[model samples]
Target: MYGAFWRILPGPWWIRLLIVLVIVAIVLYSLVTWVFPWVQELTNATDVTVGG
Candidate 1:
């Protein structure tokens, strides 16, 4: 699967690396900005107690 994706990307090796980095950055940013907060709210993570 990864091999197929690498082949499908356009440009030389350095350009491909740059594109992959940009894609990773975008995914990480979205998770931090939106996905993680939504999941935290759904789970009520801050309300959990370690012991009682």
Candidate 2:
């Protein structure tokens, strides 16, 4: 399983931390791009403005 894989792979903490960060960033990006629009639709916006 994944737990075993994590235990078997030997590396520094920063390398593991970097991998976790990259995975998290990828998942977050996927959620924001593909799933966030539905979330936005569910909420009501009272005020909004774009200066640019």
Candidate 3:
């Protein structure tokens, strides 16, 4: 699967690397900005105590 993606990207190696990095950054930012907070709300993850 990864090899197919790498083959499909339309660029030289460095350009492909840059594009992949940008894609990863966008995904990470989206997850952190929206997805994580939504899941946290659903799970109530902040109100936790380890060992009182």
Candidate 4:
């Protein structure tokens, strides 16, 4: 699957690497900004205490 993705990207090696890095950055940003916070709210994990 990864091989197919690399093959599908159109560019030299450096350009392809930059594209992959940008995609990764966007995914991480969305997770941190929205997805993780939503999941935290749903789970209400902050109030839990360990061995208290």
Clashing pairs in 3: none
TM-score per candidate: 0.86, 0.53, 0.85, 0.87
lDDT, candidate 1, 1-52, per-residue tens: 9899989999999999999999999999999999998998889766768776
Question: Which consecutive 10 residues in model 1 have the weakest lDDT in total?
Answer: 43-52
Tens-digit lDDT string for candidate 3 (1-52): 9999999999899999999999999999999999998988899766778977
For residue 28, give model 3's deviation from the true position in Å. Answer: 0.2
Count of backbone collisions in candidate 3: 0
Please give, for residues 5-38, the per-residue lDDT of candidate 4 as tens digits.
9999988999999999999999999999999999
Clashing pairs in 2: none
Of 2 and 4, which scores higher on lDDT? 4
Least lDDT summed over 10 consecutive residues: which range in candidate 3? Answer: 43-52
Q: Which portions of model 3 show Cα errors greater than 4 Å?
A: 46-52
lDDT of each: 0.92, 0.77, 0.94, 0.95
